[model samples]
Target: MSQVRTKVILYNPKAVFYTMPLALIALASYLDKGIYDVKIIDGRLEKDPLMKILDSCEGAVCFAVSVLTGAPIKDALEMTIEVKKRFPELNIVWGGWHPSLFPLETLKETPVDVVVRGQGEIAFEQILTAIINGQSFQGIAGVSYKDKVTGEIVQNAERNMVDINSFPAFNYDFVPVNSYEKLSGRNQIDYIASQGCRFRCNFCADPFMYKRGWYGYAPTRIADELETLWDKYHFEHVHFQDETFFTIGARVEAIAEEFIKRKFRFSWFGTMRADQGSRLPDEVFAKCKASGLERVMIGLESGSQRMIDWMKKDIKIPQVYESAQKCLKHGIAINFSVIIGFPGETEADMDETIRVVTDLRKMSPEFRVSIFYFKPYPGNEIADALIADGYKMPQGIKEWSDFDYVVKGSPWIPEKKFREIENFKFFQRLAWSKPSLLKTPIQTLAKWRIKNKSYHLPIERKLIELIFDRQKLS
Candidate 1:
């Protein structure tokens, strides 16, 4: 008898922007330890990802894909359908956010042979073992599959959440790390220090997936990984991809102290809720700043108190102000994540949000406000209400994949109001989002005008056009 080499293909579908595919890299590290031969394909970085997958499908045992909601789902299904057409005998497994929430729905709709729910480190390893030995899929946990003989769906027990602290470090050798830097135009990369979240906001999917479970790796281990990233790749800025970085305050302080003691000055940023921010001491922020903490992204959601209560955000308007003040006082940048066009939002509510953001913009040049139209995502409380109130959910994977969060999610909002929202986004971008040599003095004057109750004639649009043209010339 001769021995056969096991080969597997792992993929990350297209996302809003090109990022280093850490998920694929992490899975490969565990699978490639003299077990299986793994190949990674990041669609965002590839010119033709479909062709790459087709070319690599030579005697492969599994074709695994990770996907998100919205556009990425659509893109993943397209690739899956093509792969099946060419290699009918290969096993296609779907994992990650979308498939985890609706495992049966995904299995019925797409050509996927299996859906690996929850964290994939252990489940994926077992699946590979079964495939290599030609065993039955009866005992696998956290997986939904179709019976080969009966052709019926069989879902096993849900997988328990694993302690990610023990997971091996990502194998960056699978892909070129320098390619990501060229695309981003900076010395930046993303790293995950924690998993899960502690809140159940109605518009989010993290709660449903992790069941509000929060976990973090040890501070010393985090420091070790970050040092490796810097020493090996010269990475300067790290984007932490946790649901909320401050779920545990003591861990944050420990991580900060570890970085400070090691004399590592890698700039970093992460998200925290406004309610969480209100409890942190000023000394923590100062220490973190000294250790290269540059900014914190806080979800303000809405400026109207009534709207805030409606969303069950559980944070007071005064807390929002306090969070912003704390960051500004310590010289840390604040990125305000705002939302409008919820189910019962009014024009008055939108006006109040605009007024609040406009006031916050005057406090510091580093303050940033990003506005997005609400989307009724699957498995969220708001999505259920929207469906009950006569809103039609997407019929299948294709329809759901086309869902856009930037536009109105429901059809209840009038066309006129939708156009008004678009115009407001344009003006907000001109005032707060863009970089301009004329920003400091001009914005300072605009702040003075608003504070003095003097409504000056509008000239920003014309001035922005002139600036754009000058940049084009240069």
Candidate 2:
């Protein structure tokens, strides 16, 4: 009697614990009849046991192995190599944003036997079915793999998943709810009511990914999925994984109105463009909050006029403050992500940023500020220009790799100076301003420890040590 071979897959690396990549694969599992005994390893809960991941499965797939987001690709590749080292006959694959952008480079650098780029819902299922039948991946759509016989790069045209409803709701059964709850500050899981984005921000690939088109799910369908999650899992919160959640206000209004009608006041959060906040007044925010829009993340690329124009962000500094003020007044908790360095920023530019963070803090003590280094993603105007001009990304000396690795293109500010601006001193000025409650730094990490005990201990220690060391030297 022949033994049945089980299919195993592993996913790792998430920016937010609100959503899981394994959920997408599990959706594929629903279409499957369990003929192959499918299994999943969620890296978000904790790092997966690599040897076990390799030894346990006949075939497997990983996500995001190409761009800056996949900066630690060498580590990801090494894992696959280890798997192949142990099981010479095992099949390995890669997927997500990194693969979608640089499939060719990924094939060369990693032991990724195959890659599924873009939306891999149907494509993933097809790959498993084909491998089970002992077929080659020559004709798989949205997949790229080596042509062993031809010794050439073989890639299929990108296939975008338009019917998001066709995909099953994100499942938490595979991942412990406690683990996710601990990381994301909510007990509920999330789903994509929409896919792709329409904005043409030069630094982001959303517009590039969808050919500048945005796709959304039906309101009824979305409501049905959320209702199922609430009804079945007894979940009381949700996170919508939409790039610009209120891109079409009507869709959002419809969803919010449905919640009001059903009395489903579930806590939820979503990302949105900053300018839109000005248009949505206090009444709209009250409605959203009542229906459960607890938090919103807005990206303020920079406070400097010159820096803002260079990135072609379209939105201006005044708009940022206005939008921020509106959100604050409305009682809608705001989580801001600010970009510090960009092309041609001066001391004045950095100071302007200090001013913005200072004012925003005055509005509320509960407001959260997330500071990030500027990055030039692929297919972006800035990235293309930089690569054309022989720009080198700087990895921080003390802090190792992070979003800070990408040195901004500003000619006036050296990478070190930019790092200094982001360091502890910049934050101390603002934090020391108010003696009440012992203010945390406006810059987040003052080259020193940030006040948020929620942050990792190592990061906190390093930041504190770095800032203190710098202070002692001064």
Candidate 3:
């Protein structure tokens, strides 16, 4: 007779987007099925997630949550606190971006027993083994735990980054792909072909988390797994969620060739840097296009050369244009994300960004530009510098819950400048958006306002906001 396998429940907190919980899935899939029974509960999909989680925790030995930096922290905390209230003996683990950044800090919370840092597959396995055998977490690398007897936090040495190829392929059966498709309004699957990032942008957290290390699955492995997934799910699209999917040009080329050779019938998208895109040969681009490359997202963080250099973007402004021209030539859609409101940025710098955005918008209607204010996310060079210069970060979970990277206003930006940037964003969206019968006139006026830089009376914006606010409340 087989021994009973202990249940391990993994929870993914509710998020704004419908993207599947790949992180939780990673932890779940890494566990050995013979000894551990892992059940993943995504808060986003449940009507009463807390009740469901409590129901599932009846016989579970461990309750692990994957948390991000912002609003998800609130939900995760609430759920974990409730779980601790009910199942005091169960080991509660917190892992992912927020916990990785603040391992010791996260342990101060009453619920979280252990915090897993970077690349948690191996570490998570060790943690589970230790918990099951009633062993000490003293020697577990990449883990921080509170001593049960002494009540002191112990942070182990950091673990080196591991190659993703060594891990088991993602088990899509763990998630309801059809439900995700319905939620996203696209018959697509989200996948991470690689882990960590090589580039060290000052505003990014990848460098501090991964120590500038990067690893990707072998192209053949990715192709084989994707083919199996396609056959199983019949999805039409694959969205690669890697930070820098095109880091190795030859690897990208090989992946594309595999996709083409397999005769896969799905389109795909990935993230790319301007420097990487510019350096790719024309033939490589052609191969990718032929292999169902539908769209690519490029982070052109700033337009001013000086700002780019200051941020350690390591790419020239000319490379941005070069990449754009290549994408246009290949008939691919491009989404260029730009950041504004950085520390020490001037009006002249904002103007340069606007000029570049306008030029990119004019390139092709298929090209899209997304503008956002720079939020000082921790675990980055800029955030470290700000901390050194006396910038106070959020103290605890409640404070961090209010941190919104996309919509939050930065302290460095004055009110007038903020309004100006907001108006520009509104007009820029309307001016380049696909027009309908009701929006053509508004689009024309928006274009005129953008051209003349005249945003004195934004009555339309106010009215639209009023309508949306009412709808949201209703």
Candidate 4:
């Protein structure tokens, strides 16, 4: 063969998880080294008609599957098997949260030849190039691989986390500029300024991934990346995938300054904690908004202090209220994310959450509530316990975390309850998960305005009247 390019990574662009830029970081390294020909495709958010993913990279020594998307676990694994069956020379691999914890199970069950139990950027690159060069991968850090001779899984020593500067700014040349426009109706791209979370929320997978170190990209580099995207790709919007944009409020302020300096600011969104929002100064909030941070999502998790205590969320009722005031005053729209139906849920908890959402709405007409059912993602701390408790879930459990799957998954919530008041499933099915019905019109107009408009954020009162009004009419 004259030359062979034998590595690729597939990101399910349609996934609710929009954090594939990390994988892109690793792919960029492979391309720069010139040791292998590498290509990456974000299948998420893309409207690619043909299934050209597997066929795109031939004799691919290895493929990296992004598991955070959660939609493609079964299909991505199946595709790996199919690729292996068709191309006998190729090695299929799986990574990210889904495969990392279940290395042996995933490897044996699927066509996956390798699993990167930790960060994959370097480990995957090293392992793939070795496989291509017909070399040994005995000591590569952060890899779980089956020995060709023994067929036993070998997990190498742990890989230290990456410094942000080790990688280049995201180069989207692999993606057509038109693709972003076509998919989002805006030039939407995602970037991350950080790698790990500080807290150990029982309901999340961060505790398993990051352990306890704080990692972040350089501020100037991030600002530069934004400018580069704007200059090169004509990208007009960004959704920062940072776990908490305000965790390092200073860094966020620096980023805003850079954006203001560069004149490349675009409408952006990111998630932050309630505590961060409350502590965030009005000046910083103003800078964020002026820098085009139009929307900020807060993970309130629960209205019940009991539930918060149990999940170790470390939030206070007052923090929620203060955060609302800060967001509203700064002209930044708030999308409050609430999680209900954890193990210790009661009527009062639900009542309090409804109250908080309603009060936030009165503070500003732009406030919206995004209520989600408690999910035990594959690697979440609760998954093992729940699976052991013999709690049988319906087949739709795969998509239960997704709002679109809420209709089918809702039956598990309260068999007779959701149909009347908080029937997310009804709207999910009737409206086909349309945005018009899910959060926008229903939250601000019909559901949230139940209380008088005021500076005080209400957390346990009727704020809007969408579902109840319809019921009254009926």
Best by lDDT: 3
- Runs of candidate 1 with Cα error greater than 4 angstroms are 1-5, 408-423, 429-474
Preferred candidate (lDDT higher): 1 or 2: 1
Worst 10 residues of 1 by lDDT: 465-474
Better of 2 and 3 by TM-score: 3
RMSD of each: 3.3, 6.6, 2.6, 6.6
Give RMSD (Å) of candidate 4 vs. truth.
6.6
Better of 1 and 4 by TM-score: 1
Estimated TM-score for each candidate: 0.91, 0.79, 0.96, 0.82
lDDT of the candidates, in the order given: 0.81, 0.62, 0.90, 0.65
Candidate 2 lDDT (Cα, whole model)?
0.62
Q: Which pairs of residues have clashing backbones in candidate 2?
A: 344-410, 423-446, 423-447, 424-446, 424-447, 448-463, 449-464
Q: Over 4 Å off in model 4, which ranges?
A: 1-22, 42-54, 387-417, 420-474
List the candidate numbers ranked by lDDT, top first. Answer: 3, 1, 4, 2
Models sorted by TM-score, best on top: 3, 1, 4, 2
Q: Report the C-alpha lDDT of model 4 over 35-92, residue by residue, as the tens digit.
A: 5566666666445512566576465566666664345565565556666777766666
User: Which 10-residue span in candidate 4 carries the lowest summed lDDT?
Assistant: 425-434
Q: How displaced is residue 287 in candidate 2, in Å?
A: 1.0
